[model samples]
Target chain A: MADPAANGNTDSGGSRIGRVPAGYWLAGAFLLVVPSFASNFVMYQIFGWSFILGMISLSLMFLAGYGGMFSLAQMTVAGLAGYVVAICGTSAITDISQNWPWYINIPAALLIAAIFATIVGWLAVRTEGIYTIMITLAVASAFFYFTRQNYVLFNGFSGFNGIFPPQLFGVDWRNPIAFYYLALFWAVFWYLAVLYVSRSPMGLALQGIRDNPRRMAALGFDVTLHRVAAYTFAAFPAAIGGILLTWQSAQISPGTAGIGPVIDILVIAVIGGLRHPIGPFVGAFVYVILKSFSIDILVALGMAGERFQLLIGLGFLAIVFWSPDGLLGLWAKLRDLNRRDPLIGRLVRRL
Target chain B: MKTRTLLAVLAATFLTATAHAQTLKVGALATLEGTYTALGEDGMRGLRLALSQANNMAGGREIEIIVAGTDASPDSAVRAARKVVEQDGVELLIGPLSGSEGIALRDYSKTQPHVTFINGISGAQETTFVDPSENFFRFNMDGAQWSAGLGEYIYNVKGYETIATIAEDYSFTYTQVLGLALGYCAAGGEITERIWVPLGTKDFASIIAALPDDVDALYLGLGGGDAVNFLNQYQQAGGDAQLVGGTIMVDGTVLSSKGDAKNALIGVPSSGPQADTWDDPNWQAFVKAYQDEFPPDQRFPSPSLMATGYYNATTAAVSCLNEVGGDLSDGQAAFRSCLSNLVLDAPNGEIKLDGNRQAIGTNFISEVVELEDGTLATQLVKIVPNVNQTLGIDPETFAGFGVPGRDVPECKSSY
Candidate 1:
């Protein structure tokens, strides 16, 4: 299949010239206006979660798609940020939080998360392929246990609750519209950042490393450093997402970094199409919608509520089988098929 | 013309009165699809049974239940609660079957000030005792309150002088261990060894090996599949330390799955109500109602502790609603006051919330016994009446007692 990026026909120069595409502007406008039409539930559950989870999975996507590194530690990085936020902010479980101002807490959480990710990435980048996955998984598992058992730090398994989003500008940041816009700003910022990086010279170098790491290393591209950089870059957004997630849920616990959720982010990235910047958000939307409604749907169909996971697994499996690149890849394939047959292509485009 | 005008006014008033009988929306949140699924299902069943008995009417208004799955995480529970409140527009919320979820929901209750939240089997002490919410009420006891008399039961009745404690390393387990240790130590017993296992520790070989041979009993505070794994592994290892602790150790699922291993629990006193063995008419009726709703099948033969907890909470909520005549237009404050003053005739006995909105009710130390049918059952042997959130300790001292842990309560010979 052709590269989705190539089909866009935009170059680094286009981005450098600050020539924003019409579609991009239209999408931005749509997102900005979503708060007006969307209900508070939609804003919180659908958009809020999609943006946060998308940012987390996008980190994974950037690493996997560009650097050829599949780190299971993206959610772990997010969890680290959440823990930092809780520990630095007021919470129900502990008095350990310094109760610092939001300005201090948010940045400190992100910095610590990024540092943690960098250290993990530095250790993990030494390995390749499945070994990279295994090492990251091990790190994730270790973090989960560490947080769960270390009562003085992570407050044991109950974790920290009442970690509210900072009330800023004399407004509660968690209020539906405010929270939505806050999430939107970060999500869009990261999405564009990922897009720009993917087209930059460094991004091209990382992609080269992804395609042929030995060759890139032999050619003096410093492959390990690039991979580590990818991880560090990815951690920033993930950490922000983690902070947002902590604010969204008003709590942080071992479950946030559990093995199940760590894998779910990978699935979301893959299901959305890891090759593209927009894939994670697309996948997150699908996942969040299904997760929110699958139980009710199954119960309505006279099935047990627990079968919701089964349905989700089946859906993921079907998508993977149908198109290795996920839903976006499938869409790309259909579009390619249409282009082959102009008559059908016109009809398809019209539809 | 005067007669026609009078008739029109009467018609308008009658229409307005009929419209006032709106359906009352209530949300039921539980970990309906994860590790604690059995507990969540049992809770839902108990809730539905209570609602059925109430004819689905509360305060002269038809009740509409909106169920959301919590997935047993604090994050998911908060999200589920939000969906139920913001999306489904439920006036009241019940649920979130785990400790962390309870704390999260309590925090969330502050955000939704007008929404009344009744606890659904979440035993985390912090949900009420540590940081109580005015809009939140728990009719069921916290983990510590549930294990009120177990220590005494083990020391005085079971003759366990020095016992070892093995519990899941979490706030809930910590609270459970504290409860057991308090009663045991107060009765002149000792906890010689304390083993805190991480939540998902499947292999108990090392943990079993760590158990001191000198202890009279090994109190087990693990729950669900973890409990099942620990018990099976302990038995397989030929470890014969008498097991006793909290409700989770001898839950219905654990009993049936343990098979011949179930014998080890016989005469071992633990916490929680045992449906099959409780002789109280109210409990029997509740069991009958549950069985009628969910007949004896491959799933459940009798109601579990989760069921009883939800049933009691729902019963309390409905009773309060009945008293208020379904008028919450005055908002959660009116309902909060009503709940504060209300004393519920729960199946276990009278359940009344103390100053902190935590239940002060009967806490049973039930003995594991083989029923006539050869099924394992927990039979209530002792009742600690009016077991409060403070566990009989003064609030200030109890607050300073620190969070339950491997080392807390400073074991003494007497209370």
Candidate 2:
């Protein structure tokens, strides 16, 4: 078993490596450009949502792949951040909130989201595996109810709209394609940054703790501290996602923290294989694209749009039962097998 | 720099083309997904139904309504609107289902001065009575217009002394609930307590449990699914009270899904698409056309946000368009000058735009009752004409949240 405390990074005087898996990056680019070219409408709806969901799923990747923590509340944390944006940053004309200028309000929103996430992490990180899942789920459910009933703050059901994107480059960055690329750039940064961190000493220690908590403790790794730190680190990406969601929707409703959306992050992470960095994001892309189009398909088949949840749930179950390692893991296995089977390839070429 | 210059030139060209277009391009912006998906879909249907009917105008020039549906957020709405106006070059626009999205469009309407925004049933009172922009025209009832008749009846007709209101805590509900309070208090009824719940709240027991008998009636200010949920829970919990609302109650759309809410509440609503369509053969043909396109079950019992309010709003616009010979300036000026002077027939009434751009003429106060056939329905028990008077503030002084006063309206009378 790998030591949870051992960092993936070998300290070679902080040398930057230009090397990356070209095939994987190529595959990703292929996926990104296809939808943008196929239809402008799809670009806005599917592409935009995927990148935001990608950042959200990255939070789960941090916990599961790095810290060996399986968390369900990462999406809830992101949603809480979105609610914070709505409350603090929204202009009075859109939501009930007045323009609480960016300098003061943005920091306050992020700080509050971080503190909220930390408290959630403090509670959930105590348990392991399924128990942790349950606790995280309960926290998500609790937040959902709080936001739903507490009308004065969350605007109750019909959520506040009219959050204009910050005019950084003098453009309403709320435009879907622009927001999607921004989110993509951020997701890439988080991915690379997390990759580097995973190779660092802290990441190694966390991995050690994840593999054998008792052994890591004996080696002075502070197992609980490592778990909590992992959760906190995970929250930063989720919060970034939440902030982006505030941009995408231009308004945050109580539904932002609702049960379905929170659980959706878990499904994405697990379906893409919780074992890898790129897994959750890959799963999110599949989920968002399928979901955006499935409505029309369902309507054609004489099904209600509300049946969307039912379809997604069934798909998730199918993924879990049939392929525990998820689609990415399956692809990797197929590729490895093809590489080894030179005889089979030669036979096929001859035929 | 090149992108900026191109965009500027493109936008300018688009605006110029829009102003000079012979074929009318009407932008339909809405949500075809998520919680209020049905409402958004309905709004879109109204646009299709209206646009198709509108294209059969006197002149042979085709009026093509280009549509755009977003995920029903202010951000998405703005982006979608920009695409419609800038990319598509629509002369006029409609829809964006939610009050919040409509408000965003109202702001955007300022940038494109000549583009007339015929709203799609976003009934925030501020959209008209407060923030009335020259480019924007709200063709349906605001929160106050829909609730005014019922408010007057509950206060004066029924002599209900005290009332409690349960509504979704968004701006639509807030403005709606407040409209009820304003009307009720004006006619001598005191609102004892107000409970604002979220839109998709599955349960209402805790809220219902909190209610006391101090109030004679309860006002349910929710729509479609949430309304059904609230009423079902309220009734099952043994809370026996006369329920009323500024929302759909026993109407076709409400009753079809919520057969359980039968005889449980009095519903006060402005005219809906299917409600009055039973009397019109043309409307029957339209419903037949709709059923031919989509299955009867897939469509709501009545035109909801789309068929009901949005269709009516569009029909009003069509009427105005026809009256002014398809000229936007003439249409808007005619609407603004003497809306009630319009003799155009409609599913609702004469297509009249009041001073505040709200449809004036009649507000229906209906009672929820069970038919012998065991179907739930609202029978129009009352109709209050020119209900725009209930706004209290006169024809002028309609502005935004800031400036005059965005505070909750204060009632001087306790009794």
Please name the candidate that would achieve the greatest DockQ relative to the true structure. 1
Candidate 2's fnat? 0.16
Q: Give the lDDT of residue B404 in candidate 2.
A: 18
Model 2, position B101: C-alpha lDDT score: 70
Q: Which residue window of length 10 is worst by lDDT in model 1 chain A?
A: A1-10
Native contacts present in each candidate (fraction): 0.45, 0.16
Best by lDDT: 1
Instruction: Give TM-score, chain B, model 1.
Output: 0.90
Worst lDDT run of 10 residues, candidate 1 chain B, spans: B11-20
Which stretches of model 1 miss by more than 4 angstroms?
A4-19, A341-351, B1-21, B332-334
Which residue pairs clash in candidate 1? Answer: B59-B326, B151-B184
Over the stretch B76-156, how does candidate 2's per-residue lDDT look in tens digits?
577678666755567678876776677777877876776778788776666665556777776666665666656677877
- CAPRI-style quality class for the chain A–B interface of candidate 2: incorrect
Tens-place lDDT digits, model 2, residues A1-351: 122222343434543543333454555565455434433434455556666787788788778776667778888888787777777776543545757776766676667777877887899878888888888888888887776666577755555666656677776676656665677678777877777777778887877777788998898777887778788878888888888887675667656666777877877887876666667766786687455444435646776544554676677778778778766666555645655647555323122
